[model samples]
Target chain A: DTAVSQTPKYLVTQMGNDKSIKCEQNLGHDTMYWYKQDSKKFLKIMFSYNNKELIINETVPNRFSPKSPDKAHLNLHINSLELGDSAVYFCASSQAFTGIGEAFFGQGTRLTVV
Target chain B: SQQGEEDPQALSIQEGENATMNCSYKTSINNLQWYRQNSGRGLVHLILIRSNEREKHSGRLRVTLDTSKKSSSLLITASRAADTASYFCATGGGTSGSRLTFGEGTQLTVNP
Candidate 1:
């Protein structure tokens, strides 16, 4: 069984379009996170949710929004996508808190905006 | 500003050789975590060493944390071709909300 799973592994869209990437965790974790990896392989934390509530939001533009329907699922929606928004988005889930806790990650969602 | 930055962005070594990646952080922290990412994959948690602890080992992976120097190092012994991946150091704790800040990363290639 996949501990963490993300749908739409590959997405190719045009500029100014909107899309959503779905993520789910079967580990019964309370916290989930959204991370973006750019072409240079730089990973940046975009958002994190704990118990279906927004816990952390990085300095990302408002175009990107993260929604967690429950502790098991967290989804990312990108609005008004631009060329620079093309990257791989990863969804992860952790048991809770930061005390030596390990995070399980999904495969990843590769978004390419032309 | 990136809270953490890793040294030697890339390294290539032969199989059975040891690979070491160093990471330095800018601020104080309660614990540090190490993650690995293969090509086109998400990050995988490897090992974590806390600020109070100096070193920890799991399998063939070893992690060390130095509070004075504000740095950490990850060592993989007897590396294999399958171990070729990018390693990242993420800092957490001592911050509100418990959000993690990840370092740039180190790409290691173990040629069989």
Candidate 2:
């Protein structure tokens, strides 16, 4: 079984179009995160949810919104997507909110906004 | 802002040679982790070194941490072509929540 999985492994859309990426983890974790990897392979944290509650929100643009319906799922929705939104998005889950535990990451979704 | 910065944005080496990558972070951390990412794939955890530890080894990979210097290094011995991937250093810190700040990543290419 895949510990972490994200849907729409690849997304291609025009600028201004909205899209959503779904992430789910079966690792029975309490914390989940969304990270973005740019063209330079720089990984940046966008949001974090613990037990379905928002815990960390970075300096990402307002167009990106993350919603966690439950502890097992964290979904990212992008509104008015721009060219800068093109990047690979990864979903990860950890056992706790503490930094001690290792996180399980999904295969990642590559988004391309033209 | 990125908490960690990895040295040598790119490295190339032949098989059987050793590869070393350095990372420096800005803040105090509870633990530091190294991850490897193959092209078009997600990041995979390689090893973790806590703030209290100075060195750790797993197979051909070795990791060292210096909290006073706020730096860490990952050494891979007997490199193989399959080891061609990007290596990233992430710092785990924050008072209440678990947040890992990742470096830009070092691209290592091991030629057979």
Candidate 3:
């Protein structure tokens, strides 16, 4: 079974559009995260949820929102997406709220905004 | 800001050679982890070393952590083409006790 899976591996949409990306993890993890990878290959943390509670909200634009329906799923929704949002989005899960818990990332969803 | 930043954004080496990548972090960390990402795939956990540990090795991969200096290094010995991917260093530690913060990955190309 795929431990973590994301939908629509490739997304292409015009600017000012709204899109949502779904992510699911069957590893029974309690913590989930969203990371953004820019053109420079820099992976930056966007949001994290622990047991469906929001934590670690980076300086991301308000247009971007991350939702965790349950412990095993975390989804990202972008409103009024802009050209600057064109990048790969990765969803990850960790065992629990530990200091050194390693995250299992999904095959990133590449979003291209025009 | 990124917690970890890797030097030499790209690396190319022949098979059976060794490749070393360095990462520097800004704040104190409880532990550092290494991950590899192949093309069209998610990142895979390679190894993790706590701050108190200086060096650790697993098969062909060696990881060294310097807590005082807030730096770490990943060394892949006798690499293979299969190791051709991007390597990232992630640090986990925050006042609120949060998840890991990954670095700008180092793209390594192992040529056979």
DockQ of predicted candidate 1: 0.64
Look at candidate 3 and give me any clashing residue pairs: none
Per-residue lDDT tens digits for candidate 3, residues B34-109, read 9999987789999999888999999999999988888999999999999999999999875326868889989999
For model 3, what fraction of the real interface contacts is kept?
Answer: 0.83
Evaluate all candidate structures by whole-model CA lDDT and list the values in order. Answer: 0.89, 0.93, 0.91
The TM-score of candidate 1's chain A against the true chain A comes to 0.96
Better model by lDDT: candidate 1 vs candidate 3: 3
Pairs clashing within candidate 2: none
Model 3 misplaced stretches (Cα beyond 4 Å): B94-96
Write candidate 3's Cα lDDT for A1-114 as tens digits. Answer: 999999989999999999999999999999999999888878888999999999879899999988888899999999998999999999999985868487899999999999
Higher-DockQ candidate among 2 and 3?
Answer: 3
Q: How do the residues A3-33 of candidate 1 rate in per-residue lDDT, one tens digit apiece?
A: 9999999999999999999999999889899
- Please tell me what DockQ candidate 3 reaches: 0.76
Query: For model 2, how does the per-residue alpha-carbon lDDT over B19-100 read when each residue is reduced to its tens digit?
Result: 9999999887889999999999999999988888999999999999998898999999999999999999988865324798
By TM-score, how accurate is candidate 3?
Answer: 0.96
TM-score of chain A of 3: 0.97
True contacts kept of each: 0.61, 0.74, 0.83
